[model samples]
Target: MTRSSNAPLSVVLAGGGSAGHVSPLLAIAHAIKATVPEAAIVAVGTKDGLETRLVPAAGFELAFIDRIPFPRRPSLDLLKLPMRMSRAIATAKSILRDANADVLVGVGGYVCTPMYLAAKSLGVPIVIHEANTKAGLANKVGARYTTFVGTAFAATQIRHAHLVGMPMRKAVATLDRAAERAAARERLGLDADRPTLIVTGGSLGALRINKAVAASLEALAAAGIQTLHITGKGKAVETASGELLTAPLYQQREYVDGMEDVYAAADLLLCRSGAGTVSEVAAVGLPAVFVPLPIGNGEQARNAAELVAAGAALLVDDASLDAAWIAENVIPLCKDDLRLATMGESAKHLGIRDAAESMAAMVLAASGK
Candidate 1:
């Protein structure tokens, strides 16, 4: 790897397709800057990925590469894969050369596949962060090129994986629910004295979760549990107008810009078990009922496994998360203060609050900074 004299350490972080990959890359970028104030951090992503907006908004310089996905199955697309991949790698290599990056950090995504190959071609040091228990293809391939590997889940079996935990944003990593409960409840229009259940289907809204929770709203409300449901964009959940609305025990919001308040006010969480979601909830010490998405390599279930084993979370299948399940399981769980508190403590114990700092240190060490 080439090192420039009299220049601050230059890092080119590559990943993006969804928030799952981009969020950790941004978290690490922030951590690197915090550790070395003069460090130059550049983000590399495809034009169509979420990073197009998220990276720029995070105040990082973004470099684009062509989007060329690996051919998973034989098709006409497979015949053209080689040429497309070559172009992507060339574009990524140009960016790394232009930035004179000392190291290339990759999180799992289609973009990172080419970025890792490009960095390897240039003899630059490579570091990869795998955020799922079942490692993604990009990270799996990238792991072969580097000894410095970070992982969100302890069970991830990468070649040299270190359990650095998920790099959480400051708001989530250090949040104390008890300290901010009153004001957080006031801001979210939730009852301060009552038990609150926060049901989320992520930003896109899970149809199963939305439908099931809506069907179970009455039972939850009857159990004296208030609900704040984030119905994502384009989701419309119908609730009865009289007592529920007047009492405002069931609050449905499309989105919350400040999620810290929502976390503080929540006593129980009901959501999908994506890697980021699992890590964030665990980091904040929130007891959750995780409903793994019934798609995508079963990584969501694997992501929640450790938490479930640690008594921090309960796993439910997507098909089983209906009204009856909520009434039989969630309603009683919400009312049991001792159980909820115990689970919350278990979640906190399993989380790593300084993961970003640990990842930053790994990057620095790999770069010989």
Candidate 2:
């Protein structure tokens, strides 16, 4: 609202808590910089959130505000909500003013609620990107005040929503998996000529996935497949007898920075179906078996629904993802070269590669500068 049409734009982006929120938020920031080289991009987040580390690392100025979470049930915390919200909104207002924010872009988190309310009161243009198939409470509240809304999935129930897909880091958005495969395999120490599966349970790891993969490792090795199993920080797949379970063809890694190498080296991805993971995997055309975490209103399952229906990915219940399921479904899928190729093609067809640019344009347009 402060910038004129010919002047460089100033944008405030708010999203925090999880990497799911921060990843897409950073992608949008990168896109905005690409389009408007002089644009002032200020990211607002709680000090306690991942943004403290991630935003500064990504070369953006980060501002902090108090987090005011909505209570789910009747409690004394609910009674104290107004005072907390007021303080957070006041802090958000200061950040917007300091940045001369013409537009406030929110990817939805506890940080966004205060920022959205502050932006509404200050008459700054609001643009929102909801990443989940089912909108979160913070984004739902934001949608009520802003017509400029974009979503990762088609079925997100926000008023005047645009299905612009998830914003991806430029590296991931433009990845050429087939072309990068050889070097990527080399980088990950994977066999370049062998069929490969990458199983990642994310940073905190999935106990069910790690256990199942550990149990099925011998079978995977017999079928001539190599695996890069990411067990998360300080966690690993262990035997029932409390022994570290590993195989010769199986590699255990704690994490992969940037994720491009892992994606390129993978013939198939076995992971959870969080919105960011689903969007990234589909965009990269990696055939996948999605194990949606069975929590939070079943949104993860919904996030994977489109790809699963397209045969780009397969979905299985979290409870059903055991050794038998991996052997019966995953091993056979990994062994089928023709099927993997088919699924990769299907995934590529459904992916929107330009989402970062598109979302950037949407936010810029809403700035009215």
Considering every candidate listed, which one attains the maximal TM-score? 2
Q: What stretches of model 2 exceed 4 Å from their correct place?
A: 1-7, 239-244
How many collisions between residues are there in candidate 1? 0
| Residue 310 miss distance in model 2 (angstroms) | 0.9
User: Each model's TM-score, in the order given?
Assistant: 0.95, 0.96
For 1-369, candidate 1 gives per-residue lDDT tens digits of 233455589999999988888999999999999999888888998889889999999999998887777778999999999999999889889989988998999998888889999999999999999999988888888999999999998999888989999997888888998999999999998888998999898878888998888787778888899999898887757545522222247878878877778879988999999899999888889999999999988989999999999999899999988999999999999989999999999999998888889999999999986
The alpha-carbon deviation from the true structure for residue 64 of candidate 1, after best TM-score superposition, in angstroms, is 0.8
Candidate 1 wrong stretches, greater than 4 Å: 1-7, 238-248
Residue-wise C-alpha lDDT for candidate 2, range 1-369, written one tens digit per residue:
233355488999999889999999999999999999888888988889899999999998898888888999989999999999999999999888877788999999999999999999999999999999999899999999988999999988987799998998888889999999999999999888998999998767888888888888888999898999998887877667987776879989878897988889999999999999999998999999999988789999999999999999999999999888988999899889999999999999888878888888988789875
Q: How many backbone clashes does candidate 2 have?
A: 2
Q: Give candidate 1's error at residue 96 in angstroms.
A: 0.2
Q: Cα lDDT for residue 124, model 2?
A: 93
